[model samples]
Target: MSTFKAPKGTFDLIPPYSATYLAVRDAISGPLRRSGYGYVETPGFEDVNLFARGVGESTDIVTKEMYTLTTKGGSELALRPEGTASVLRAALEASLHKQGNLPVKLWYSGSYYRYERPQKGRYRHFSQVGAEAIGAEDPALDAELIILADQAYRSLGLRNFRILLNSLGDKECRPVYREVLQGFLRGLDLDEETRRRIEINPLRVLDDKRAEVQKQLVGAPSLADHLCDACKAYHSEVRALLTAAGVAFEDDEKLVRGLDYYTRTTFEFVHDGLGSQSAVGGGGRYDGLSEMIGGPALPSVGWALGVDRTVLALEAEGIELDIPPATSVFAVPLGEEARRVLFGLVTELRKAGVATDFGYGAKSLKSHMKNAHRSGARYALVAGERDLAEGLVQLKDMETGEQEPIALDRVVEELRAKSA
Candidate 1:
C-alpha cells in the first residue's frame, strides 16, 4: 500500500465530497457579493510581527499557534493564523482604505494556518469564509455584517447555531473593567496560563472553559456592568438592530475575544453539539485595530466562519447538503468508430453548457450500462456502428431503464428539452 498521507490536521476534499465544500463556499460568498462586498486575496505569509502585534501578544494564536520561519534574508515570516490582520495589511498597502469610501467592505474564502492540537472542528491548517468592513465603525455596519452571516447560514438550512453577543466596552471603559476583573481573578484558584491571561487582557480570562475556573469566576465583573455611557448606547443600538431584524442572540458577558485590538463589541457563533470546540466561528467590533496596525483611525467589524466547522454542524444536525450531480449525461459508444465520433460530440455538448461524460474503454454493452447506472447520470446515450449508419442513437433513461432511438445529431437538443 502507498504510505504517503495528507499532512496531519489536514484532509483532502476529493471529488463528490468536494462538491459540498465548494457549494458551501459559493453560497456564503454569494450574499456578500450582493451586499456590496468585493473580493480580496492576501499573501499566505506575512511579517511575523504583523500577526504578533495585530492578533495580540497575549493571545494563544500569537504566543503558541503561529507558524513562523526565519528566512535566509534574516527576515521572520509566519503563515497567517487568521484573515483579518492580513486583509487589513493588504488594504493599507494598496491604499484601498483611502478610496473615499466610509468602509471598504470585502469578502474572502481561503485556507489559514495555525500550529495547534488537531481535533474535531479545529485543525492546524483549516479553511475560513471571512468578511471585513474596514474604515467605518457604525453600529449599523456591525449589525449588517452579523445579519449577512446569519443569512448565509439560514440559506444553507442551518437552524441549530447560536449567536452569542457581548460588548467589551470601549477604550474608556474596558481598561477600568480590565483592572477590576484582574484584581478579582488574581484571588481565584486558576491555572498559570489563564492567570497570565488575566494580566494581559483580563476579559479573556472570563472566556475560560474549565468548570472549576468558570464557577469560581462566575462572580467576576461583567463588561456590561462597566460599559461607558457611549459604549452602553452603542451596544443597545446593535442589540436593537439585531432584534428588529429578527436575529436571535444571547447576551454573553464572558465573550471577551482574546485580542488586544478588539473593543466596543465581541461575539461568537456556537453549535451546541461541538463540545469543547463549540464555537463554529465569530467576530465583532474592533474600532482600534486599524490604528494599532499603523493605519488611519478606521473603525471596523468582521467575522470568520470556519468552513470545516460549518460542515461538522451540518453533520451533527443530520442535514444532508443537496450537492448536484457531477455530470448530467453519460455517453456510451458501442464500437471504436462510435467512440471516436461520440467523443467529439460530448465535447460539443459540454461547450453548450451540458455536463457530459463518456466511457473510456471498449467494454460490453451491459458493462457500460451498469457503469452508467453507477455513474449518477440522468440519461445515457448509446451509439453503435449500426445505429450511426441510420443517423440515430439509443437514449436510455438510467433511472427508469427505458430506451429509445433518437437522431444522433438531436441527442444534445433532446437532453436540453428533457432537463428543461
Candidate 2:
C-alpha cells in the first residue's frame, strides 16, 4: 500500500517554520489591533455570486482560479479566493453597518483558496492577514490602511519592499478613460482573449505581465490623466497623508488592481527579492463593493498581506525571525516512582506559567536526556527514586552544562524564577 500525501499544489505548515508564520501574522496584525481595528473571522466558502459580482467577471480570479462547488441543495458556493468581498458580505449580513458605526473597521486572518498552478509564493491554499474599513469614503482612511501596512513590514525588519499607488478613477471618469484605452487596445495585434478583455475591462490589460502585451501598452493612455476633479482631490489627499506619515510610495499610472470594484485609490506592496511572485500584498478602495453584493452603498478600503509570501521575502533577505524555543524545561524521570513525582512537578511547573515538557516513554536516563536536548529546552529536570526520597531533583542547565540539586517542593518556584 502507498502512503497518503497532501494534495498536489498544496503544502502543510509544520513546526519551526509554522512558528515563523505565526510570528509574521502577529507582526502584521499588531498595528491594526492597536489602531482600533477589531478582529473578524468568516467561513472558508461563500456564495459564488458574491465573488462574481464583487471581484469582477473579467478577472482571472473569478473566471479561472476560483474553486467552486454545488451542494446537494443546489446552492453554488466557492472557496473564497480573496478576502474583501466575503468580509463585506459578512459585515452587511450581520447588520454591522446599521449599528451606528459609519465605518466598520475590521481585521481578519485566514486561509484563501485558488486553483492556480502552485509556485514558490503562489499556492493552492495560502494564508493572509487582511483589514477592511467599510462605509467611509474619506481619503485619510485610505492613507491609514496603507500606512499601517507599511508599518507592519518595517516592524518585521523588511526594507526592500516598495509601495505602488494609483487612482482608478471613480464611476464618473473611469468609463471615459476605459473607452479611450479600449480604442487603443483594439488597434493592437492581440489574441481573441486580449481583445475581449479590452471591451470588458481595459485596465486589466495594462496589468498584463506578458512581454508582448506590455510592449503594446507602452503608449496606452494613463489613468492619472483621466481622473475627475473629485477623484483627483481624493487621491491627492491620500498621497499627501502617506507622504506626511513617512510612508514612501510610487505613483504608478497603470496600477488598476485586478478587481472590478476598486475606485479612486489602489496600492500594492512589492518586494524585489522575490522573483516573479513579488507582490507580498495589495488592496484598494472598493467604494461600490457593498452595493454590488446587495448591501447599501458602504464605500470601503482594505489590504491583504500574504503570510506565505512575506515568509519567503524574509528568507530572500536572509532574515531569521527571533522565535523563542517552545519548550523551556524538559522533565526526565528515572523510574516509576520518579515518573509520578516528576510528572506532578511538570504539571505544577506548567500551571505556574512555565513551558514544560516531559520525556514520555523513555526508559533510560541517557535516552530521556537525548529527548530533552532534541526538544530545544534550556533546562532539564531529572529525578530518580533516591533523589525524590531525599526531597530533591537535579536541575541541569542545558546551555551551561551545570547541574544542581533543588528541594523537590520548591521545583515550581525555582524554575519560574529562572525562566523569568
Candidate 3:
C-alpha cells in the first residue's frame, strides 16, 4: 500500500459503496426534480464575509467550524459549511430574482467542508442533497418542501425517521423573546462563553446540548409562546397545510437550527437510530437571509438531506436497495483468434446498451471463469479457436450452469433479449 493516506477526516468512496452513495443522493433529489426544482451549483469556497454575514458570526458554524483561508491576493475565503447561503448568493448574483419568476426553485448535490471532531454520521467533508425556493412566503411552499422530503425518504423505504418542527418568530416579536431568554439565562449558573452567546444570539443558548445548560433551561421562555399575531397566524397556516398533506411532525419548541437567519417556520428530520447525530436533515424559512447578504428582500424556504446520515439510517434499519449489478455479461476468450472475435463482439454488445465486461491477456479458462463469477455477471460468453472457425460462441448461464452454442451473428441479439 502507498505510504500516504487520505486526509485525516475525509474518505474515498470506491466501487460497490460508491454505487450506494449515488443511489442515496439520487433518491433524495428525484422528488425535487419532478417538483420543478431546477439544478444549480456554486463554487466550493466563497468570500468569508458571505457566510459571516448570512450564517451569523456568533453561530458555531461561522465562528468555529468554517475553514477560512487568506489568498495570495489577501482576500479572505472560506470553504462552505452549508448549502443555503451559497445557493442564495448564486441566485442573487445571476439576477434570477429580477426575471419576475417568483420563488426560483433549485436543487443541488455536492460536498461541504467544516472543521469538527469526526464521529458516526458526522464528517469534516460530507455530501448533501438540497433544494431552495426563493422569493415566496406562502405556507404551501413550506409544506411542499417538507412533503417532498418526506416522500423522498419514504421512497427509499425508510420509516423510522421523525420530523421535528418549530417556529422561530420573525423580526416583529423575536427580539422580545430574546430579551426574556437572556434575562433567564443570566440568572442561571452558566459559563462566561454561554453568557456571551446570550448577548450575541440568545436563540443559540436554547440549542445547547450540554446537560448542565439544558437542565438550567427547563422553564426558559419559548419563542413559540411569544410570537406576535402575524407570526402566530403564519405558523398556524404552515402547520395546517402540513396536516392537510398528511405529513406528521412533532412540535419542538427549542428547535432553533444552528443558523441565525431562520425565521417563522423551522424544522429538522431526525432518526432515533443515529446515536448522538439524530438529525438526518433539516431547513427552515430564511426570510431575512437575502437582506442580510445584501440582496433584495426575498422570502425563501428550503431543506437539505444528509446523504451520509441517510445511508447510516438505512444500515441501522437493515434496508438494502435493489440496485442492479454494473455488468450483466462477462466475455472470456480462449485463444488468439477467439480474443479478436470476442473483443469485437464485446464492443458491439456494449454499443447496443448491454452491460458487459471482459478478461484481458491469455489466461486459463478456470481463472477467467472465476473472474466472471466474482464480477456478478448474469451470463458468461466463452469462445475458442475451434468455436470461432465454426462461427459460434458458447453462452453459459452463470446462475444455472447451463451452456449452449449460438452462432456468432446471433450472440448480440440473444444477449440483448435476455437482458431486456
Best by lDDT: 3
TM-score of each: 0.97, 0.98, 0.98
Off by over 4 Å in 2: none
**What is the Å distance of residue 60 in model 2 from its true position?**
0.5
Question: What's the candidate order when arranged by decreasing lDDT?
Answer: 3, 2, 1
lDDT comparison, 1 vs 2, better candidate: 2
Candidate 1 colliding pairs: none
- lDDT value for candidate 3? 0.94
Candidate 2 RMSD to the real structure: 1.0
Instruction: Please report, in order, the local distance difference test score of every candidate based on alpha carbons.
Output: 0.87, 0.93, 0.94
Candidate 3 per-residue lDDT, tens place, 297-388, comes to: 99999999999999999998999998899999999999888888999999999999999999887789999999999899999999998898
Judged by lDDT against the true structure, how good is candidate 2? 0.93
Better model by TM-score: candidate 1 vs candidate 3: 3
Worst 10 residues of 2 by lDDT: 1-10
Off by over 4 Å in 3: none
TM-score, prediction 3: 0.98
